[model samples]
Target: MSDEACRLDVWLHRARFMRTRALAAAFVEAGRVRVTRGGVQQRVDRPGRTVRIGDELVSPSAAA
Candidate 1:
């Protein structure tokens, strides 16, 4: 996390991935999102997790 870090759910919604913040948080809580940065990749199980710029986010496909 950094000074500019934002909540993962908020970022997801701001990025236009989900139509609503609640949905974004739900998606993250379901462990359907993964983040990769600094050569580290891990699942996002908590919507409140801190996300910073340059962090790579991977979401499950619609068909999943």
Candidate 2:
């Protein structure tokens, strides 16, 4: 899907989305991130999904 379908957990950590791979996988399984398709958003669940730079992640603000 991407240059290579990255392990979502690894991408999340490399992109600074989570402190650890485990946390990234947890967030993904919990439906905390959104994946865009045809300009529509969908929940991301699988840890093996492809991700890319500039892909929006729907995470709660720390202040919230």
Candidate 3:
């Protein structure tokens, strides 16, 4: 992926959602993550999925 786009797992870590990339990947694999762009939302089940700026990501509750 280009610099403008990053792996979903990496983004999750950078955005402080998950403590580590591995955790992010696991969360995604569990189908607990969703991504929205241009008013369309899609479940992200792959950690390697490309994510870009302005893309909205929905992750499971961190407290749980």
RMSD of each: 1.8, 2.6, 1.3
TM per candidate comes to 0.86, 0.69, 0.85
lDDT of 1 by residue, 1-64 (tens): 5678999999889889889999998999999989998989999899999988898888779578
Candidate 2's TM-score reads 0.69
lDDT of 3 by residue, 1-64 (tens): 7788999988888888889999989989989989999999999899999989899988668677
The parts of candidate 2 lying over 4 Å away from their true place are 1-5, 62-64
Worst 10 residues of 1 by lDDT: 55-64
CA lDDT scores, all candidates in order: 0.90, 0.74, 0.88
If ranked by lDDT, best first, what sequence of candidates would result? 1, 3, 2
Residue pairs with backbone overlap in model 2: none
lDDT of 2: 0.74
Encode model 2's per-residue lDDT on 16-40: one tens digit a residue.
9689999888888877778775567
Candidate 1 TM-score to native: 0.86
